[model samples]
Target chain A: MTAAVEIAGITKRFGEVVAVDNIDLQIDDGEFFAMLGPSGCGKTTTLRMIAGLEFPTEGSLKIFGNEVGTLPPNKRPVNTVFQNYALFPHMSVRDNVSFGLRMQGTTKSEANRRAGELIELVQLTGLESRKPGQLSGGQQQRVALARALVNKPKVLLLDEPLGALDLKLRQEMQNELKSLQRELGVSFVFVTHDQEEALTMSDRIAVMDKGKLLQVGTAEELYERPLNRFVADFIGQTNLLDATVADDDMIVLGNGTKIKAPNPHSPGTKVAMSLRPEAIEIGRRGDVPADHVATSLNGVVSAMNYLGHSLVYQVKIDWIDLEVRTDPVASEDRLGPGDDVSIWWDRTADWVVPDE
Target chain B: MSGVITPRGASRTLLSINSLLVFLFFYAPIILLIIFSFSDNRNVGVWGGFTLDWYGEFADSQPTRKALWNSIQIAVASTIVSVVLGTLGALALERFTFRGKQVFDALLYLPIIIPDVTMAVMMLLFFAELAGVLGLSKGFATITLSHIAFSISFVSVVVRARIAGMDERLEEAAMDLYASRWQAFRYVTLPLIMPGILGGGLLALTLSLDDVVITQFVAGPGWTTLPVFVFGLIRKGVTPLINAVSVVMLLASMALVALSLFVQRVRTTDSA
Candidate 1:
């Protein structure tokens, strides 16, 4: 697969503040790639550099294998859907969509004709004469989308495009945007602070922190196998256990339970064993054991929560607290506070990292 | 302007009274000056049964006519120059950040606060030496310079306020739509800022036209602006012709302000 955008060693600075450090990246043709990070982490800046709105201070950006280092934003073959919709306040919906065509010196008739077609595509067919202020926020977003998409550029950049919408509208827009990308088949570089949004929309996600790209991978890879504690914590919830590697495949935790993990480690090395809440099981058993690959500990259910789709139980064993998903609809064996049970898990469920 | 109110009776009467007082305070003298303009009598108090005598006097005299024409010329020239430079300056100030920005803005606004008399004296001295070296006289050149210098601050302030109120993200949005900076300015920034530029230009035009103190110091033998001409007329005695000119000035100002208010309302309704 040929890459459409190759961002090689891109670095941008605002005086002493380094907004984007030297970054090397490539985006495939017609793929939806998301740059995910917290605010001020340089994800938006990186998107700007890629769009040519910002020139990287110390590196190169290539579009379709052409070195576009000194190209102005208008010269770049990318369009952006801004976060706040930024629909031209003075222009009618149709004129707003036709703006890019007009700039390219297309005939007025042709521009209007094309804009009308694009407007329909975005499902804003009748609201043509209305100015941006007349429309609701969601409607404004659609108009913004139509305006940018009308140009049919090589790539489209959306900077948290759904950020201004209510939660329900945002979820609806996320699905629409995903489907739109699929239908258009244009390379898309999206920037968002929302990890869940990135997970839902991205073909690949690049997680950045403090001007550095921490890890870039598929959502599944990043979710199931994060590169570090930061990526692990950022992507999803993980219960980090303080433990020591007793030997290869075995970790003797501080609470006197020895658990087995698949990864090999040196003996006596301190580690943080990451256990996904779904990994642990809550059940009552007369016999309980602790071993390398499979382990069990006797505990009492400290709390029980019905989580719509699943039941969650907080179990206190000896001294340590463990969270487990229990049977949600078990009438006879409903776990509650002070109910004794054994919490167990398969070794495959946890990822162990050297904490110290 | 409304006379009726729903359970509010004396409040509206008070409002009308306040409005009338404000109008009377500002415009009564201008109306008097206009009435006096038609008086044929040398004494402005007694309107000698309505005559076009002062208008005739004002128009027939070559020097007075030339001075008025010269003022118009200066206002047009100064307005065009100040507007272009001031608009661009406002754009640059809004778009970029550099060192001494606060100082720069303060310096721009300084002329408005400084005493005009001091500026005239200082500029006169500066121009006198420069003119001597250049072997040229200060009249059109000096007055034009003063008007432009003073008008730039007004123009810049208005344009800056207009630009600052604009949503900055709109430019980024334009860029996202593959628009060049120039295109964005042409389609977006220029249209939005046109009102401020026009408004500022009108203010500068009015200022340049009516100025007396600065024009007195700067006028050469060949160049006598309308204000200077009017001042000379006043020195002779308070003629009704001066009143005539004053009324015309007042009318022009009213027209300009009305246009601005109308434009502002339309813009609000059209956009919002």
Candidate 2:
């Protein structure tokens, strides 16, 4: 299928400040793509440019092969659900959902009928006449989704649509939004600051920071093989161990531990190795099987936290804290702070990320 | 509740006393005037038997009636002009940034900050100079224009406050839903700020109706507003007739104020 949205060499400058640096991306049709970044990372700006709410100072933006950079928002073939669910406060739920159709010159009866179907799809069937103010936050969010989807635009842009909801409601809405996009089979560009949300819902995720696109790939690809230090630290918790390249496939850590990585630079080239906490195995000395252990380090447990299903232990070794997460098991002796333990992990789990 | 009640009782009692004093200071003179308006005596401050004679006399006064008509005409014209101009001015100031914006903002508040006497003098001199150059004379038109000039600032202040309180995302949402800029403003921004526009209009109407000094400086032959006429009557003497007229004007002003407050309340409730 042809690309649903194509951005080429887009750079949005406000006076002397660059809000979005040179960015070129292609979003496939029917793909659930996410732009993940912290605040002021230009994720929302890029989304706005795609929706035609903003025009790039330097580039071409196309939707389904049609150049739409200079088009106004009203002329774009896309709809946005704003961060605050910006539903028209003066209009009823039905009117708000029907607004796009009415603006497109659809007759009132047809618009209302279409809106009614979307309302039911969002599970807000009886709230057709209620004003936005009378509804709860979650209901309002669903109303916003229905309103944007009711237009049946080629692309749907959502800017942190679940940021306002509580944790439980956010999870529920996240699933609903994912299923809705699946059912519609339309391109969805979801902008969020949440790594978990992006990982859970996106077919592909783009990590951005400070007006620059850092990395873009599938969730597993980006998480397991973050190309730079920012992405490796941003996606999840990881303890970075500074190391110098020892050979073509090995590096020496500051603590003198030798590890193997996929791509090795020249000898003495500084690198950072990223190790996930869950990948590390922790046990008393002589407990771990020799066949499963590739490398081992001894350290004292500095801190231990019980998380019901799992126990997180921070092991202090040679002035570096290595985190180990494991499922809780029945034992008379539990690992507590100040307990000596051995931590080991598979050599394949050591991933090399760019320094700085 | 009991734990929280120890130190607040004295403050609450003091607040009530302060409110009582404020009410007395504000309403005592107006209450006295209303009471005397119904007295049969010719002079005020001496109560005679209750009678509606002064009100009857006020109704029969032809000069007072003509002055009332002139005030209404000026108020209506000036209110409409000021509301339209002020709403546009507020939209420009609050929604857009342009060159000399700070200077324009400072100038917008000039009419509001200048004293009434100074403003009246300045307007009179400016109008007189223009009238001389154009071979014109000051009259109803000059008075209406001056009223509008001063009233525009008041209207813009109110409307700008309303705009500031409004959510800009509503208009953006409208535009995203395929509304043109004009359509978005007409359907969303205009309705949201209508209460402020009405409040400003009522304020302008009341200001024009109550203007005495500006009208005095600008009025030509046979062009006296109610306030100017009432000032003249006060200079001649204080009478029950004056009291009756003042009471009626006060009631009308009060009604307009009440309506303005009611509009603001409705707008707040709608938004909430």
Candidate 3:
């Protein structure tokens, strides 16, 4: 199937500053694609260019295999739910939703009937009479979603639509938005600064940094196989260890430990290895496996935090602090800040790459 | 203010005092004019007596009625011309990023900064130059044009502030909904700018209604506006009739203020 939206080598620049570097992405039809990054990472700008709110300084955009770069936003079959929900504060929810249809020259009755269906879809049935200010943040978000969806856009662009909601409401809206996207069977190009939001809703996540596409993959894939240090550090938590490349697939650690990986590094080249905290296990010396499948490192438990079901131990290795998560129920011996401990992990779990 | 209390209590007190001072400053002259308007005394002093005779006389006065009619025409014409130009000028000043903006800002604010006498004289000089070139004379048209030129600058100044704070994303959202530039302006920008449009119109109307210095310079043998007529009346010494007329002007000013406040309150609430 053709992608609903295809951004090819898009580059945006403000004189000397490159806001979005040469980047290419293809979003499948009816798929939830998230462009996740920190602020100023060009996620919102990318979405804007796609929505025709902005024109890319270079390259082209295609909707269903047709170039839409020069097209005005109104001509494009896409809608956007802007941050703060940008609902027409002067108009009630129904009118706000009907505005797009009205602009498209829909008859009054037709527009209102379509808006009524959308209102119910967003679970804001009775709120059609309330102005944007009279509704709660969640309700306003629903109104914005309903308003955008009322036009039956081929793709809906959301620029951090849930950023204004409280934590609990934001989480609820996240699931609600995902389900709504699925129900509508329209591709959604969501821009968000929150990784968890991207991970929760996206079929494929594009992690961006400094206007560059760091990596694009499923949540688990991006987290498990981040291409570089930026992606690894950004997608989730990882402690980078200094290592010397042993071969195309192996690297020797600082404390004389060795690990294997699929990454290509020249022998004796300086490389960085990422080890996830949960992958590392805490145990007594005799419990260690006498095989090359795992690498063990000795450290002292500097601090132990009891996190309901699990305990997080801040373990001090030779020269670095390593976080280790262990089951609190099984760990009968409570370790204090200064307690010595051994940390072990499968050698395959260590992700080795060029130092960057 | 104690450490226990923030500026909240003190600010509220300050706001109340400011409101009281403003109310007194605005209404005290109107109150005096009203009291003197109804007085039957030929010489209004300490309210010698109350009667409707002055009102009857003022109403029957031909020159007074004509002056009133002339003021209305000039004010209405100037307001229409000024507001249209003022709104466009304000939007241009606020929206587009351009060269000479600092210069434009200073130019827009120049009419307000200069003394009324200076503004009146400059306008007279410009009009004299125009008449010399085009073989014309200062008249009702000249007076109306002068009012529009000076008061439009005031209207633009009042509106530009509101326009500056307006959310530009509303226009973007409008376009995203498939609205063309014209549609975006008509639907999104126009409604958002209604308050500022009204503000500019009111400013222009009020300024034109009360203009004295500019009108005195611009009006020729053919023109006689209310302020000019009032000046001629005052030269003959203040009368119960002048006070009577003044009372009517005072009431009209009050009504204009009430209308403006009503627009402002409604616009502010709508925006909120």
Best by lDDT: 2
Each candidate: what lDDT? 0.84, 0.90, 0.85
| DockQ of predicted candidate 1 | 0.62
By DockQ, the better pick of 1 and 2 is 1
Full ranking by DockQ: 1, 3, 2
Stretches off by above 4 angstroms in model 2 are: A255-258, A264-269, A282-311, A327-344, B1-25, B46-53, B134-136, B261-272
Which scores higher on lDDT, 1 or 3?
3
Q: Tell how far residue B44 is off in model 1, in angstroms.
A: 1.3
Instruction: Select the stronger candidate by DockQ from 2 and 3.
Output: 3
Candidate 3 lDDT tens digits, A89-189: 77778888999999999999999999999999888988778888899889988999988998989999999998999999999988898888888899999
**For candidate 3, lDDT tens digit of each residue in B25-122?**
99887778888888877786557788989889888988888888889999999999988888888888888868998898789878888898998999
How many Å off is the CA of B259 in candidate 3?
Answer: 3.1
**Chain A: TM-score in each model:** 0.89, 0.93, 0.94
Locate the minimum summed-lDDT window of 10 residues in model 1 chain A: A285-294
The runs of at least 3 residues in candidate 3 whose Cα sits more than 4 Å from the true structure, single-residue gaps closed, are: A252-262, A268-270, A285-287, A328-340, B1-29, B39-53, B134-136, B262-272
Error of 2 at B41 (Å): 3.9
Tens digit per residue, CA lDDT, model 2, B1-272: 66765436888899889999999999999999999999888778899989998888889999999998899999999999999999999999999999999999999989999999999999889988899686657778999999999999999999999999998888888889999999899888998888889988998999999998888998988899998998999999988989989998999898888877887788767665
